[model samples]
Target: MNLRRILAGGTATIFATTALVACSSSDSEDGEGPIRIGTTDASKSAWTVFEEQAEARDIDLEVVNFGDYSTPNQALSQDELDVNLFQHLKFLAEYNVGSDDDLTPVGASEIVPLALFWKDKDSLDGIEGESIALPNDPSNQGRAINVLVQAGLITLKTPGLITPTPADIDEEASKVSIIPVDAAQTTVAYGEGTPAIINNSFLDRAGIDPNTAVFEDDPESEEAEPYINVFVTKAEDAEDPRVAELVELWHSEEVQNAVATDSAGTSVPVERNAAELQEILDRLEEAERNA
Candidate 1:
């Protein structure tokens, strides 16, 4: 059972011309073909375990790896892939509303804490009035802003806005100013001696230690619901039992252990049924529409 992997780049332009493939279905009663799933974490050992487990159940699985956050959804939306497991509720909401699509989440994975990496500073102390770089993407940018708020470095005008922008920052009340850069550039900013709020995905590539973060949001907190990574598929396929089985398999001790090891134990496993996950996505979509 060979697991095929497709490596994409950070830019969407590289994926723009990808030829559309036949849409996949979770209901494979005839044992048609492999159920192809897209993800950014294909290199992780957890996926190898997942594939092995799926093969044991006579489930043909193919894992297509993506580099950028944009293409998986695009491929999924275009019916080129069956399902993708790379984003959280907030990111999915943003993509759905912005693209006018209804790609749905079928299972909850885990939430990896976003952290503020300061190569120089030991803590948030004495960082007042300094510039901190963060991901500019809508979903992460808002979360990044909240991390600062949680760190007592900044205050938002709307108090508890989960997806606030830089304009929403109460400049006079905040201790530090935010520099919104491309998501990948956060490390570049940090490398240049500026403090950066980076996503866990970029940590390994940048050789930044996840434990070195001066501050990080609590993954177990209720406020972290929007950040829970999910297995997403087309809305029509949300009720597929095969997909649900695959989701459950992800929580198996073997796969879960591999996931924890891959993320350096920073990834907190979460268990929310499809309905609960959908409710969170709905609320986030509503907020995104309003915003």
Candidate 2:
């Protein structure tokens, strides 16, 4: 993917500071120390396979798990983690814009469809005037709204916005109202008989089969570009060969099998190069700034 030139000729400025820490894996000899990676899904079996694959290549890896979405980038920026692989470009754009950071994606990962689950309802029909549950976070909330729009349940005041929020909904024209809840609690709301937009991470933990979703957004659609997951590191470390190697390892057959299993066959693996990912991130960051 030529991750060595992630931001080469890109719009974002790269700082000239030295390494964040003296013992950073970037500075260490090959396999000298563990490359610390922050993720929200360390317990997923895919990560175990990823770790074993890294070991096979003499790349020591330490998987640091985070409980929430807010901390991984902070940990990476603070030099506590070498990289993070949890969020999509949209979420990362929001974080980068909000925090004024330039962490860059080194490779593209899979995109899992954000799906609607209902405990009682079998389809989108008969849900008029119903309260739908969605993740309260801006990124997921916006995507959830789009999912409803695609399902013919809602309409937006302004069509085609990348990160539309609940406020952007044309409530007068929409058939259903939204109830924003924590991402982890969407399953709870679903169990309570509310049709919820559940992210893949929370689906498996709650014992929900992703394939059983009543409705789901198409992962390969143009609107899904912002939702493509990625492996991100500080912009300064973008060119590290080891980082590229780690990204390549993630696509290995064994690791991808685990990923498919972990995501219950919902994950659509993507293969965008570093420059392509950076271009997407740049566009998202610009939209975030204007929004």
Candidate 3:
């Protein structure tokens, strides 16, 4: 609001304010300049297609790659990036809460489902007494548990929760020994012929064929809503015309084809409005506040 100081000044004060406002505006509007998008190597192939598709439409959308998961949100919040296509709702909520920033989603992007990889067993039924490795991160660990619970391999004492640890397992009713491993270690563990849970992003690095997944979760479910990847901008840009345009481009047939074909069906595109994403963020923020 205080873009300029007007001490009962003339029209010159008004011009300064106008310039500041324009400077702060998102690059997404009118395709005037390149809109930088932050993402990781996991979605590198799909984003390449998105970038190409965006350029042909007269929009200069650029994808900026980062090696670590923690860098993109920081870059976006600092205005070093225009928007980000890297994080899901729960992770974003956690980042927003932890950083005390107001970053919000402008559009829902995709839901990369978690898969269970088995070495010796063909199905969950034959995996009795096997020590199955799971991602140790909070959000992923919970999702890994849910996949096993749904597959009847394991049961949680607290069912339907977003994050359940190894302690939450109900030993009496479970069929497999669920073990926690470093999220990056899941692929290595699974590659050793040990049954394990692997996230879609890490499948390529782990050298695992996604087609060999014994079980996968329904990413469209209400429980999976928090896991949906999104195009996030600052809260102020939520309703920007350019943000809407970029989102529309993503959901268009051209980009959708790129997302599907380039990602090899790993990133499932899900179109959701800002309201739906905000609702989930609000709930998470409230939970954080209470905690």
Candidate 4:
């Protein structure tokens, strides 16, 4: 996560611009200041519900949208955002490692599982030597490979390992040509040709039907752990009264129902205890260190 390099990368330029605006507006704890939140545009519904909840609590809520995955953590680290709700523990850990920032998750949100979609085929075996598009980001690229392994389309040297990369691809089946493209471009690639795996967000944005996806990430499996989006803030802010209040609100029945009905299953709020969330975060942090 070279912030400069990532910013220079066109994928997240919109997020960077929004972060600049947020930083400019966050000069004081003035009565006029809103609790600025950084998140991807795909999670618009959750942000709407969060804004409503914040308003009900008399807290001004400002929602900032990011185009790429890297900018939210960067914005949060720079205090441009009070919090972010776009990435999972794995991505957060990677951000922490790359930026040396101490951010912590306050609550878990949806599990937007990655799916392998193809316009021409129903199964991986059926489309041999087919061109596949995958997210170029390291975390997602590795996760997509794991999905391929899970589907028995390919095998990794170590199964059940977190963040396995292409270097770890052991059994290379001749039919599959795993191509790395920008995560945001995966859906577009599908329209142009066959894509082996596309992030759920990209697929949804492209209007691809999830039910018709050729291969989907197993939401119930450990491999999908890295894709579970969560609300995150500075570690020191994790226990702040306001943070706790918002986390509780996000998990409330009202918000849960809103997510289910409004998101059309794009987001699945985690219904885990505080202790369990901590355990998951801790495990993911450890995995990131090893990776």
Candidate 5:
């Protein structure tokens, strides 16, 4: 895959155009060819579930792996993939604004909570002026700030919201020096020195023990609502019959059990009302536009 085009520009322009072109071209050749799924390279358990579910459905499922958070949504918007299952509504909304992509979420997936890990300290208060690494992606960076605020280590002017940037920090109560790093490198940042707020998948990839972390986002908290990962497709095809079928399959007893067992509580299935889900997505999109 061409990584350069995938990584170019703001989320609205580059990704949206790519998604539009890809989807338009693919739609002409074969609408029912296969269910092409896009996802990040970080989550192993989700990949397993995708494979198992596809096999059971006897449907051809192609998994396109992306190195960064931006590409998957771009590919999905362009119809390069039938669906993508890697990002939360917050990230999706940011991409929509940054790229002007009209993507829509069809299914709710796991919640891989953001966690703050320290190589030197066991408590948040012990770390003063320590360099803290965060995901460079807008959504996760905001999440890291929220995690810090939750730990009482910092204060965000807008708490319990998505895509909050460094500029959003109140500064009065915020002390730690925040460092933005690539999502994949945040785990390594922790090992290099200073504490880092690593996403769940990266932490797992780096073999970091979650118990050693001084703080973690509360999975059940209201702050986590925007971060609930989803399976998304283009807005036009959002309510397609196949899309509903696929979502039902994912929420099935067998699949849910598999996800729960495989992720070991890291990926939980959320029961959300349809209107409520749309409201959350709308709020995120509004936030992204206003940002």
Candidate 6:
């Protein structure tokens, strides 16, 4: 992770102009293949911006959309994709630790909030002793706890830790009991009348409106760095010139604007250099191992 903001004035306009020119004038450059990118529907529009921007650099950026979260990284690990742009640093670090993969981030993307969703209930005030459903995975469980603490439904004896467990819950002060289930199960888990903390990635499948979220994290805060999504590639390609250009274009006004509008203003764009990001990843991975 050696990311830096590609700060050049009028870069977005240049990218747009170059992309339009290349797309209309050329098919493929000598010794260059399409730069395949894998991501979810949430960021598809944002990638479209990157794809177009890549054209200006004579790189044919192809987007491979995945319906399930599990397959994108698997494909990337197997060389099925040149890069992937969906997972946050925590999820990616957890995946790398578990799979022994060396996939790494090259650019900071967006930070989507972990929201509390409930059907037939307007707010947390109406709920009580509810058997709340949340992610069972170590990385996200702690995030859910932080959201609960913010909502005043529970308290952590030691607050602000990136990874917290139910054992960390102050039960006597907790307004609701937690039912930890698999990450995908959280969507259906909410249907059973128990409010659940849902990751933004699964909101479409869960059919919940993000704006209606009863609680959310502060996307601009330092606490949100661990959750920022990123443009990632295998460790070996981290500094490939083409990858560098793609990452630079990602921070361009066009792509950043797409991220804001396409996510319906839910995901917040944040910038972090590689060294700073790696520091966060190291801490998260250590916590995952201990958990």
**For this target, which candidate reaches the highest lDDT against the unseen true structure?**
1
Candidate 4 lDDT (Cα, 0 to 1):
0.68
Give the range where candidate 3 is weakest over 10 consecutive residues by summed lDDT.
Answer: 1-10
CA shift of 48, model 1, Å: 1.4
| Superior by lDDT: candidate 2 or candidate 5 | 2
The TM-score obtained by model 1 is: 0.85
The candidates, ranked best first by lDDT, are: 1, 2, 3, 6, 5, 4
Q: TM-score per candidate, in order?
A: 0.85, 0.81, 0.82, 0.75, 0.74, 0.73
The TM-score obtained by model 4 is: 0.75
Candidate 2 lDDT over 1-291, as tens digits, reads: 000101111221121112223335553334355677778787789988888787777776666665567777876887757788998898889899999999999998899888999986667788898999999987788889989988889899999888888889999999999999999989999988889999887887888878788999988776788999999999988887778888899999999999999878999898999899899899999998998
Off by over 4 Å in 2: 1-26, 29-34
Worst 10 residues of 1 by lDDT: 16-25
Candidate 5: residue pairs that collide: 11-98, 11-99, 12-98, 12-99, 12-100, 13-99, 19-77, 19-78, 23-78
- Superior candidate under lDDT, 3 versus 6: 3
RMSD of 3: 8.9
Ranking by TM-score: 1, 3, 2, 4, 5, 6
Q: Cα miss at 137, model 5 (Å)? A: 4.3
lDDT of 6 by residue, 187-212 (tens): 89777767888877688776777888
